[model samples]
Target chain A: MMIDFSLYVITNRDLSRNKTIIEVVEEVIQGGATIIQIREKNLPTRIFFENAQTIGKITKKAGIPLIINDRLDIALAVDANGVHLGDEDLPLKYARKVAPHLIIGYSAGSICEARKAEEDGADYLGVGSVFSTKTKIDAGEAIGAKKLEEIKRAVSIPVVAIGGITLVNLPEVIQSGVDGVAVVSSIIGAESPFQATKKFRFTIDYLRKGKIC
Target chain B: MMIDFSLYVITNRDLSRNKTIIEVVEEVIQGGATIIQIREKNLPTRIFFENAQTIGKITKKAGIPLIINDRLDIALAVDANGVHLGDEDLPLKYARKVAPHLIIGYSAGSICEARKAEEDGADYLGVGSVFSTKTKIDAGEAIGAKKLEEIKRAVSIPVVAIGGITLVNLPEVIQSGVDGVAVVSSIIGAESPFQATKKFRFTIDYLRKGKIC
Candidate 1:
């Protein structure tokens, strides 16, 4: 599947909060997220699968491909659009072999990793914790705007700035040379996810027009 | 969860001839494969998940932990013991945070990866494609027994030898110091997965005891 180069949103799989991953996913998709990823941490397999399948069905229905974070099985199970691998995940080439047509993405920690992911045929790179994020307990501090510039200059694929990226900093992230932004709390924990995603979409639209959203 | 240091087997997902994953997994479990990983590289995700869910139930029922070869989502869904992250899968540390108690394993391409896997907090390492096998197409030639030895010496966690491991080459793989063996065609692709696993179980038992099984 060709990746949606616009905006990518990382879905939170906390069944308790999400209650219904598909329901919540539908709302996010409606908010204009082109790509969906299920990044649920620590839950029984039963819970994750049920949630993945539910969300997968919703994302598929929306014509937006759902990507599983880290788990190939869940992605395969839910027939996700593809997978997003972190610096710690499997290499792109091998993952491609596992699911030849999968839209494989890699997280680049260093410029070298970003370049290597491109060399390894990664469809895209999720490149940063642009700002501190509460999603992860110990995310390496922001990889820095300069690091993003170096990585962007080094590769030709889409690079989405992650880690604490939000509407407030969307302008800065885009100026840093990222193709898009990846958000968690900005959408997951937002008062209104729909407005949040639309706000992000507007931000990117403005940026392309040589302004800020 | 603590790993079953005794023996682990890798195989093409048993969804095909076995009809459902549960049946295939139960048969192998009976033969003493403590860990079962689904590595169905060529199938579609929908079919793969159907099969994985079936086997996941079986493994969960039998008290055996099922592992998804390279996908973290499937593992999360089935809550099979953990995930076997190929060099191409997500990094082990993030995987650990996602499934804090889940056994996070890694494929080691070099001592550097193993060291990082450990510091990043990996549970174990699948050291090599012990020998070349048709089961694993285009796999880099076996890292030979030496790479396994070097990895074993370098890491403190238990190591499982992978790739082309089989009964005939069992001795050499075990001698290399890996804690267990993960195989493919040697069992699942064989005419009698039952006998194949028995042979592997016996071989591993003998090797671990430094005697004949």
Candidate 2:
């Protein structure tokens, strides 16, 4: 796991800046998004490619790499930092052939997938629904903190806990051994996303430091 | 299962017309492509949307519906006939909610996933890697035709054999009791894709008619 969790932000064109998805991404980066994954599953390829291109430029500047979800073509098109693939998406090895050094992330809902992603040369793992979420209707059952700990202990890579994570639940999840939290509606849907990110970052920093920030 | 298994056309973008993908699809439709899934995972949402729009137009003209692969975004974006998702993608239940009337296809590598897919309101199931291929790396151990039979027996829905299925061994696949066959490279990478699809259609017709093409 080359990535250590600080702030894993999943971009949403819907909520956030009410501006271009790219601007919202910039704000998140400004608010301390250490890692960003552009998951615009609905936008046209051109839109995704353009957004990725814009975001890729900024992330490169911010030293944050943008990972596209399930779209190797878009990832390659923009020369983005990397791509995130689910078990059913283009196999990581195949994606690797196309996007060589890009940091490839895999969706690991189970111990089996996490292990496979590691063996397959995944740079990091997005393990989740640390709790059930409406972020994406298809998310697997919340794996619970214990399972997160088990996976965290098992894999040598960084584990980013996703799905329904909020400040209220931050301490428990962090204690469960996750390197960082991947958020959706909580921040993107918030009236003040920057503030929300600050709170999340503050909480994570406090817990990690064993002292309130 | 809403899908007919006599002959199935794996959808392609450029293959819609005057190409091998289209030719194979049309041939299979003529011989009998009971269901057609337009699986172009490469294009952006808009491109996929546009291609699916063209495919939807054509398939509707031919009375055949098209299924988008792992893209509820493009499927809904294009208002295509249906959407197919892999196990690691979104869950069928959620996709069903979003596209109630559209056909929902699920890809499963194990009996457990197939069973889960059925419980999740899946319209059909894609079971595979019956042989290894470059399409999906980290493919499960080749389950072979016999295993397909077992899967067919296990699931009440129609089972479409996928992953590395080609003209060379479709007979054994149908003989194993699969309702349909799904191929990626066989059509996309072929020199004469139109003829290849025609040959597959003829072979399927032969199986149904109790003779070889």
The prediction achieving the highest DockQ against the true structure is 1
lDDT of 1 by residue, A1-213 (tens): 666656888877552254455666777788889888888765544467677777877777788877788666556656678888764454456566656777887887678888888888888888876777778612366777777778888899888778887767777778877777777778877766777788888777788787543
What CAPRI-style quality would you assign to candidate 1?
A: incorrect
> How many clashing residue pairs appear in each of the predictions shown?
24, 10
Q: List the residue pairs that clash in candidate 2.
A: A1-A157, A44-B46, A45-B44, A45-B45, A45-B46, A138-B91, B11-B38, B20-B193, B20-B194, B24-B197
Please compute DockQ, using alpha carbons, for every candidate against the native two-chain complex.
0.07, 0.03
Candidate 2: list runs displaced more than 4 Å: A1-4, B1-213
lDDT of 2 by residue, A33-101 (tens): 788888776665455656777788998888886778887656655666777777546666655654567
Off by over 4 Å in 1: A15-19, A137-139, B1-213
Please give each candidate's TM-score.
0.52, 0.54
